[model samples]
Target: MNPSSDDTMHTLLIRPKAGRLLFSLLCSLLFTLPAHAQEADTARVKELQGVEVVGRHVTGKLRHDSLGGMSLDLSFLDDMPRIAGNADPIRYTQLLPSVQTSSELDAGLYVQGCDNAHNGVSINGVQLYDIQHILGIFSVFNPSHYSRLQFAGSAFTASAANRLGGFIDMQRPDTLAGRVKGELSVGLISSQGTLRLPLGGKSELILSGRGAYINLLYGRWLKVEESAIRYSFCDANVTWLYRPDARNTLWLDFYGGNDRMDYQEDGENYDARLGWGNRMVSMNWEWKRRGLTLRQTAYMTRYGNRFSIERPDFRLRMPSGITDYGYRLSLRRGRWTAGTDWTLHSIRPQQPETEGERQTTTLSATRRHSTEGSLWADCRFAVARNMELLGGLRANVYTIRRSAFFSADPVLSLLWTSGYGQFRLTANVKHQYLFRTGLSAVNLPTDFWLPADERLRPQYAYGLSAEYRTDLIPGRLQLSAGLYYKRLCHQTEYIGTPFELIYGDYDYRKNLISGKGENYGLDLMIEKRTGRLTGWMSYSLGRALRRYPGRFSGTFPAGHERIHEFNAVATWKAGRRWSFGATLVWAGGTPFTPPSYFYLQNGNLLSQFGDYNSGRLSTYIRLDVSATCRIKVHGGRESGLNFSVYNANCRHNDLFWRLKFNNGQYYYAPLRPLPKKLPFLPSINYYIKF
Candidate 1:
């Protein structure tokens, strides 16, 4: 029995069911009679022409948003507490109740028990493949270049297609008209600068750049004998906006970034080097008239990495990457929106080459190509005096190696507002055409992207959620609580042993396995949005389970599952020149598979694991605090000095466990133990605006 065939049948059966359900619900709401009917008199209609209903926008605050998501501005993220002189977007999002990280040293986000690869990250309508820098410690997004970030844990809009887990969209700031402003900042690890300049009367340009000098600092002050390590990273972005008339606008954007690391061991005669980067360029045009808006975008993006190791007599090099080219067109009028997007993907898996003193060998795999296209439409309207309904549909098609797959998904959201409280219900279906395979135990740059083909089918998910939000103190305090459930199909994972690469087995396709997953969770938050003190407290309880067809028939904990999570954040303005902030995080242990026992086979010692993700790591806890002081400069300019401490508690949180085998005995050793040394780090930075 082929899994792909089963998946195709299942998709065909579910599409019509989901469509009928959404259509029926929408029809019922649309035809429902109002409590009070108005007379069909022309005089009364004319007299009521000036009357209008006023309420919050559909995409405003999380509590008010129909989709039950969160939105954060750049100002909020910039002032949040951070670690290692890094204040990137992903780090801040990890503090949210519905988001979780695999470990302290990993930057990948596991939203609502979904795999990190299942989530989608986009910037200014362009998708991003490489979102991390410095091996997942920081994100590639430069805070100075973006204006706002939005996240959805479950249900998503029709415009956000082809993702099953969650959605994260980063929007660029609007054109800064009639303004010439910029800022410069210097931190312990990197330096950054930004500038916004108006060009003539109808155009503007913005540029930002950042570079790290950690390698220079280490070499100059903290050099170690018999060993050397070097690492550096840099990123830059440019945005150009032009408005020829009041109703027409154009935009051109570019981004480039890279990270490199090199290590050497003199005693062992070993040298290793790694480098990865991304390049993207996009063009957009928009036209608006009356209440209608039309926009079109074209973009190209590439992400790739290279790794090499050199020993005394042999050397090896591995290279892999992916490239995407796409275009989108969208139109919006009042309460309705429609759009279409088409993208082409090129994937290259890692190919390794080895060179020895006596022989040279090379192993390679064929590159894969695929195409994806989607069309979506949605609208929002009032179903009753105090209720609004939003419904959308998307049709997606993917073609790889001459094989085509189609999926039709439906999304629905309803919100009821009464006084200062709101209730929301949402249901959505999503599908994905690409999957990633690599080592799950560690975060590495060698992961490869693979497209769905004849043997493998696309992944799909069904999500449902209900939420209630109320203002506890009118304009000052807000509270929200929600529950969500998600079911996933046709998920893929690598099932081969981790040592395959050592034996020159570079073909990962053979080890692929298909499975299913289910996740359910509760999210709660209390937030203060005004006054001198503003922050939020969030908590989440969740469970995630997975099962394979034959080999892991019984459900097991997913790799990213956590039973409990809690976060507290606060910022206070002490005086005109001083501000302080703090953040605390506690989470239940992450699940992992440990070796249940070991045996000798054919005079060789081997290890066997229990059920997948059967063991749990130690719980994780961290505290971070920050303070900022403002200084008045000449010409009324201002500068700020920030000081921060990460891991204030000095706890030895274990990142992972490594099994050691010697003399028919096995022992477990902890990696990245924090308590043995002064892992607590303090950093200071200075920023000036002109």
Candidate 2:
């Protein structure tokens, strides 16, 4: 986007808000060095070896943990064990507080009892609608190209509107100055590739791609026929920097992704394909002119998804997508920051649900649409040397065929530095106007299988949190702890589904569901990073509940509610030749269906779930270990091998709860209640870098 036009209009439009202008200028000045400063940062004493410092995050004092647990990267791989080679990012995040995740293959992440759909996830500001990968063993993005990742569990600014759980902000590394670097790897699930280019020294482009062959690798009985099952995806990101001089730099970033899956079953050949690629182009120009400092960021993110299925007898095409365009104009001077934020988002979920009784061939499609606009102002101030205060509010209005939704999300923050540690407190509330179903989710298993309700009301959540950060050994070791309380209302959930909507609801232009929810939880983490022995330990405890449609009553226990979860990761490094790491995670199971004789309810056999997760499943345990060895190649090129084993002990943890007779037997046979474990698969990855 060419931001100059908007910048000029913004300056003129805000000419009357003189007080805000002064405040912004004051805040920018506080982040700048004094006129007489001769040193940049004293910490740049040594050239980091194979270790890269992350970005200069804005809220450094707000978090106390040593980095690894928050956002993983390449350096931490030094001693980690490799299980074949997939480390699911969604599972990795569940180690935090109030987080409850399903089995290993479950792409769904329930935070503090919130449903899977409640969580908001994005890459470089581009929201990811489809999160499942290879039956849920991994994330959609290729891990090889990940940069810096930040996750906030509860309420955030208006930018995070629809979610009940938290916000995940992933930032890619800035384009390297004069290096052309890239990496390629081959693994069990897919073939992966990445390339980082200098782009003639002015800008850089980093692109990555992955293709999976699980359908071909493990075909069902249909494999005997003209069988088919294959999936693949790719992502590209480009960062352009304009550094005409020191103290002034402009940045433009763009990113996109595409994925698809094809399969055929029974004696029939059918194809199911999901595709969505977004373009997020942004430009941020920062400069300090005279005594005033200005930083303006203007960008737009557009996302869309299309699902199409085909067979010899039928054709189904459903497309639903969203386009979001927004910009943040912030000015900081002295100890104050003031800005305005505006955005426009439009969505169209196209689905078709026309069908006749399926004797053999079946096809269906559907859609829904919503558009919204918002405006807001943010303000911050340094009240004292180590204390600060911040506040903001956003007002948004939606346009739809039914009644429109209006909201005003508010944000408040405070920071204090004491002799013991730094305390950060934040109070946030948001009202989200989201469809019970989103079109962007079409590619995943969860997407359009449900129906849509245009009469639904907006959802709301209020969250308050207090966090503390302190250095145990100054810059070496760190510790952090925090408490959170949240209240949610008006969320949606799915109920009974007819067979016609299941296999037939191929076009996700509409969603079918009916239910509401409410929940809250607490979070905590600690870590150590300095020498070769660098890793961290984390623990989370919280709960969330729901009330979905039921024949017996109103709403009941949600499917995602879990009680406790914990994780411990540590590594030891011996010289440059060897390093070993181990990770352990334990969590209580969630509410699920139990087995019992059915009783007539509403003239239909309705078996009770038995105390909503009253039955405990087997505890989960896994040990992952990996070894790293490097050798020099020609032209000073270096290559290494990473071998990892996941679920090293191969414990059969419960994947899903099943039913059995009260006498410990099956409905009519001798089979007793049994717990199913997700299969453990190990992978080896070979990588060559240039």
Candidate 3:
């Protein structure tokens, strides 16, 4: 039989090995179909033939409109090497293709070249503003508290349209356990515990807590000759699930975390204290009847921080934060899902309070209030026998003071399944009403949140992507590849330094310049899904460029852009009692603007900056490995000991640069690297499960 045009096109697009697999699958399908337009006669059949395969497992879940997304089970984190003896969800996303962070220790996610504020992060369907603890070392989401994590790439559903970049969702287990279960872990730097208790036959409660003791165990370890620092953090999470009946369910979630840091510099006559915290609470209810389901939710969250600096002659304190109250309602029936969501925001930009030898003064930005709402609908349907279409529409409204803005966003995805594998093409348009601005070079808690207004308008993005996936070796190996492009509008870059931001006029809008950006990339990965050895290797090639009419005449590279990235991760189950994991990550350096010239005039100095993001840091490379051994307990329970080395090679990678004057000329040099003395970080943890 001759193949159709669609089949021919698909074959051409796929690789040679995948083409052959598709041919085989097509042949099997054709032969298994009924010869005539009639059902087979079951009574006359003599015997049935079948094939059974063992020792094979499905590794990842397939989600609709997930052309370049990932749906990972909680067990996936267990198989990977930990960072600082902790399994962090935000850090895991950095290992995937087409995703990047500010640096090794930064937790902010920059997806498809978008800023951290553009990405939406949520737990139990409620959006969260500050999602990290201990600065950027660890995220607030404890792996033990979450059952699954989902990352949506360029293509996202209508309900998640507000984010211009991507979406990160953490979900707890929906099922109620019949018996009591718990896990406890103690590590070199921190300790955590999770416990699940059944209230009755239909209700259950899960409690999790984590805290850091680095300050207690190794005080001033991250210190230099003239400076010393101390930092600590703690967080708690509680989730309650109630399944009163087969068709009804209710959930209550609460999370709170805080971070504190103290620093002193004797040579510079500087001393500072920084503190931040996050608190959130949410309630959800769900009901199902026949083939329809309805859900409602309400949530409230707040994040705030204070930074105080003291010198011999001056004292200054800056405070900033944001608070949100939100509500959502959704209904689903068969292939259709619709939802409405609204949120009210209260924002306080960074403002400084100063006390001099003479008097005390306070400088503050205008406190602002805003509201955002969205109506969305998503549907999936079959277009042909082997093709499906998933589409969604979102209408958003934003109100700030007396002004209002509206936008319509859309998402579309096409999926094709055959004997060989699957192919998906997706596109989406998104908008973000909130923006994040940071004073530090990297992602830090000092960053402040602001809402869109007349001067700083909302951000918009348009994205398109195509992906292909197929099994290369039955149940053992798989291949995935994708191409994506995104166009961004109304991107803002703050041109002020930390001092200017803190001491200058409170009208912060004067320091921001709006611009446009474009990002395109290619992602490829190959993995072995089963057997004694299971792992994956991935590579990404991408470019991110920005243009501002007044600030710069030419296009320049974005600060977060990384042109090349490669990662290799593997896990070996040496035996039932022992397991080993290793990972390697290498990427291009970050971009920075160097000083062009400096002049001294009348006992003062002035400098001119060079091209935007023209200088590059040294290449970044790191290797991590871990080993774990399991032991049996008295009552059939299990315990494990894990030893991990974050940067085994101790390669000191440059975090940023500093300008220096040499021979009367100015030049830029690599500043102090992170973990100044020892880049090699090792830790051990003991865990038990019952």
Candidate 4:
């Protein structure tokens, strides 16, 4: 029996050759038939019903594409309340379900109980060590330059390795623009602009610049009551894209930024100048054809910090930095991908110089050389009708001086999909050869990078997690929950004074104590996606602990650990031109170590230390609100004005506590917050796009 009309049409849709043949036959019949016959045939042919196709895409604040990865849509930043009139990526990242930050005044992603140094950050596939400015108030990445952020917590791609915690990848699109465009923004503390020019049909270029005149705006207020202080920062970016054809593309990216602070003691006789910066340039090329893809990247990056002090008796200069040259190559076809990465690191731990009346002396003038290489491969395949598996392996080699170390890490993820929701189970092992150490409790530019050698072993982490997500309201509301446990090995804690660690000429390795750590947590989140009022609420319950077998004793709370954290973010679109946003964050305070007692020793007062990380600070609470108005101009242009208030409740959330010895007694108290003159800040920003 012949198929019905609908069945025949379905077959034709499935078989392109049959559809093409039928189309050709119809054309020939129209051309050969007589006019009356053609008219009669056309009148008899029936019109087909319209067909519609729909596809799924990710939207909203958080996305779960991979087993243990979450991607954030950059557009959300535009509608959220910003700090100091600046939309910050790092600050928003800390609001993710399982993510944690050191403190309000700090800018570091402490994911899964791992420290900031354990996380990896890359821009256009190039590694960046220092990605912060203004004492962590802002990230180096401008909101206008990028559109998305990918974070891999447990299961990451093969191309991103060498990190024990999470990996953040921010890639700029390499495509030709259809027209010229530009964006300009002016805020209370800084100003930034970006311009994109189409250099013909196949090439495009982007330029961006940002400058912060904090001293110009708050110089008098920033100064201590008895001291003189000034600060400034600036950065520039350039990106070039060439797409000769559909199969080949190339990109060149360059970024450079510098931060400087000058301080003079009011009554003392010493003046100091501190500066730090980052410079990087990278080139990437890709080729794709017929289900196969190839990519290659080469880059160079440098981060340096310098501190100088001048006094009546002598002058001192201390400098430390790290420079890297790296290359990466990757290829993919179907469900398999493989890559190789290699980098050469040149580290200057510290080279201090002191000048007297007649001569200049230099200390620790040695540069450590290290090399790291890795080969990795990954594949994804279906194991059952509703189950799939993703697995990968990485082989790493590290060499510093004459010593070498090797490790093999594995990643596995299993996924099961059902009508109700999706569930994922993931396991991963990662390692880090570079270590970041500093004396400050916060993330400061003075922190330096160190290589793993014979004395200091590489750090490694093993983690296991299970997560489930579902659409509670089918396209409007969603819910996700995850539970994870991570174990860390060969962790190191610094046990030396700042002067000794940064200037004194001692075996620095001896000051480091090796230990182990464990982190376990539960993360839950619910989000509203499609509505005029959209937002997400998240809660995290976690514990991070460390055990130093020799130095202190048993396990203790990690400095950045928070036992309970809750966050809610919402944005309301009142109309086409007006919108409002608000964010609320509340969390338990982290742990600290305080002095137990004080006594007179050798004619000097000394204090016996208490248990490590035994003291907990008070709870932290913050609320922010913002309102924005946008106006449409000619030629589809847009102009906007935004007003933001940080710490709207005027709460006194302390950054940290310091030990104070007064009246022959020892105690600990909260230190003065940043922007000492102002407990809260309200800012305005004006922006335009054409």
Q: Candidate 4 regions off by >4 Å?
A: 1-61, 223-228, 264-272, 309-316, 351-361, 499-506, 598-606, 660-667, 674-677
Best by lDDT: 4
Screening candidate 1 with a backbone cut-off below 3 angstroms (N, C-alpha, C), the clashing residue pairs are none
Ranking by lDDT: 4, 3, 1, 2
**Candidate 2's C-alpha lDDT?**
0.56
Q: How well is each residue in 596-645 modelled by candidate 1, as lDDT tens digits? A: 88766774557878778888888888888999888765664669888888
Q: Candidate 1: where is the Cα deviation over 4 Å?
A: 1-64, 219-228, 264-269, 356-361, 597-606, 633-636, 660-667, 673-675
TM-score of each: 0.86, 0.73, 0.89, 0.89
RMSD of each: 10.9, 11.7, 5.8, 6.9
Q: Give the least accurate 10-residue stretch of model 4, judged by summed lDDT.
A: 1-10
Consecutive 10-residue window with the lowest summed lDDT within model 2: 2-11
State residue 637's C-alpha deviation in candidate 1, in Å: 2.7
Candidate 4 structure quality by residue, lDDT tens digits, 1-690: 112110111111224555565666678678666656555545554333333333333235666674567777787877778787787887888878888855655778888788888988888778888788777877888767765888876545555669888888776754566899888989988998888899999998999999998878777776543477788889898999999999999999899999898888664567889899999999999999999999999999999999888878768777889999999999999999999999999999855687756456778568999999999999999999778898999999999888999999898889888776788898888889999886667777777789999988999988899988876766667788999999999998877664452335545576778899999999999987656888899999999899999788878988889999998888898998998999888999888887787676554456677888898878888888999889766786889998898888788777777754444555567864545556677889998988
By how many angstroms RMSD does model 1 differ from the true structure? 10.9
Residue 596 of model 2: what lDDT?
52
